[model samples]
Target: MKRRRKKRSTKQYAVIAFYEKNNRWPAPSSQNVKERHLGEWITRCRFIRNHSPEKLTEKQIQLIDRIDADKAQKKTERWMVNYEMLKDFVEKEKRWPSVNASEPEEIRLVNWCLSQRITRKNTPKSKLNKEHIKLLDDIGFHWSSNNKRRTWKESFNLVKDYYARTGQWPAHTRDPEESRLAKWCSKMRAYKNRTDTSVTLSPGQIKKLSNLGFDWTNSQENNRRSPENTNRIWIERYHHFCEFTTNNKRYPKAKSGDPQEESLYSWWMRMAYLKRKGKLSNERIHLLDCIGFRWGKGNE
Candidate 1:
């Protein structure tokens, strides 16, 4: 479809900004902005978005770039909650430690801390402490030259994508991406398959994939329910939580001795998974927005 150029104005810029934020053109009747200006602007944006995205203005490009950078910053921040606790643990340790689900909270704390470089004092740690130095002696504990440690979302996205595109789990030897990460992939497969003793990804990532119908164990590989069935269960539970909130006028609590607390945490974890992928449905978005739930906090 050909796009007819629309007259531009100051308020029409809101349409562009909204488009950048939502990854979609808002209706001309959007009450959040100048409704009158939205019509033409939305039309033009949808046209460019679908057929000529390269024509986006410098400011529009900058806004979109900023959105991505902010998401990356939030991802880093989400990993920060355990940094201090992990650093404290390292103060008394001998060698850089290994982290598995079976490992104590201290080990998982290390895992989370390894993903953060900035300290709570707002300064980046320039030098490693004795335990950190000792810990880095283990190859798995060392950060890459690019300083990339896998965030839970990043780990899930890669493997989830690999399986989606190839219709099979990545091999232990060489995945389609590269042979360099093959060893890590092997460890991930073993952990997911329950054949390995250590955990490679966080528990939340494991559960999200399982909820998406992944079954890594060879003999139990087909254990997953149909995708539709899995999605229905998750969506229904999320709505039930929202219903509880609607009746109580607040969010559900994840607290000790509450059986529903564990379920609430799992729902939020799945929400984070969808958030990272930018795949959350609009209905859930509205409900979450109504409750003002913070996605960055995850379950904790």
Candidate 2:
């Protein structure tokens, strides 16, 4: 009598043949019925091996485990090879690889670094290997550019003295310190207006700035003073306000966590400020009145 073959050995053979021919594993969604069946069989075997190992025979168990082990080993080898290539590239270039590198190899390394950063950010610490994290950290790899910049407190202290003396935030000018402080103050205001930012001013920091009488809307006010300002621009903004009111049937709110709405609210506040100073034109006031725009206590 002929020797009996192991059950499901034919399916394993089919899967291996398919992978070798296509240079990819058979997918369950394949149009070919035979290939789809083989793909599903492999998937079931993998699931059984992971969740209920006892369900698989010794031959099936060995087949899946060996395939998985080989794939994992290859993946790990490739990762280490890329890591070494990145380290060498960085050493020679005296900088981290840029995605815009002229060479394909340098660009690939930059993408690999980006992938590593993204994986570390999205993956929980418990699920990630410390060894991999340590290897990258050893090279002084920066997860974010923010990590290398001056701290929030440092920027705050630098600007605090100037604000007290001048009664206004420093204007961005040719001077590096003035430009840096102005940019830093604008960034802080953005942090205050945004909810999705990873960095933000703490309650204590806000209180400290508040005590110093920091003008959060100073930048917005400065924009109006720019040479680009024109009556047409103001009329365009008025139309945008009318459109917003028509769409939402409500005024733009403060701290709404939307950049556009926050901008409209700031414009409304600017109008209120101009009105208080008797700088608002009678024509503009009449236009606002036509929209049933509320002023001061009536706005609430």
Candidate 3:
């Protein structure tokens, strides 16, 4: 034979109703269950104020308190994850979860939720005991798991790891995996100064890199394919172009991924700007003309 569930009392429903009506909880001495006089229960009551409120007897109140206290103690026993979040998970998935949970820590919680469905269509929130929540909480019970919730140092290390693997600091790349590293670069730049993904170098960053044994070099090539709304990155590229001319003894061509190409593109644009303002001289123009540098609107 199936066991019968205990029936709830009218006074128990009244307590819930009163809490819903009044935002704050009432004091134990505020009122009775049916707004009745408590003196009828005890003869010549000298201290009626010390008696149980909610119209329940003293023994019944003690039993409820002991039961709740015992449940709370067992719920918190060797558990760390928030029990409320687990309840929220169960409420969303009409049926209980199976074993294949995405997170390893969530697997046990899913199993606990599955176990709650003894024979019901869904395990109601009221049906969940402290033991059920406690089992889920234990899965995330280590101090090491709590460590990830605090620091961003691990996120910063992603860029450092990329730099180590490639022997170069990650640039603003759109190449799927490299682009993810570029995000870290952008974040670090934004955190330090309100800059974009250019990841410019500073004296402090240089010092930090040196201490970390990272050899960050400013190379004479750009990752920017076209000359857009940027100046500093192109300036570095121009500097590298000048170095390339001296060392390679040849003019740098437009290499798809090379630091050069359409290379002196922005440098030429800057020169044109200075020329329009009469700041550029005929001497400088004549010199670049020798290296086959393109001038005018469409990269000449």
Top candidate on lDDT is: 2
lDDT digits (tens) for residues 12-89 of candidate 3: 344445546863332222234332212111110111212323444454355345434554675566333445556566
**TM-score, prediction 2:** 0.40
User: Which parts of model 1 have CA positions greater than 4 angstroms off?
Assistant: 1-54, 79-85, 92-95, 99-300
Candidate 1, position 10, lDDT: 43
Tens digits of per-residue lDDT for model 2 on 204-299?
Answer: 988887777677674545432322224435655765666566546678887775445666787898888889899999967866664556665356
lDDT of 2: 0.67
- Lowest lDDT sum, 10 consecutive residues, model 1, at 115-124
Output the number of the TM-score-best candidate.
2
The per-prediction CA RMSD against the true structure, in angstroms, equals: 18.4, 23.1, 32.1
Query: Model 1 over residues 92-147: C-alpha lDDT tens digits?
Result: 66554443233446444543443333222222245334454454344334443233
Question: Which TM-score value belongs to model 3?
Answer: 0.22
Q: Which one wins by TM-score: 1 or 2?
A: 2
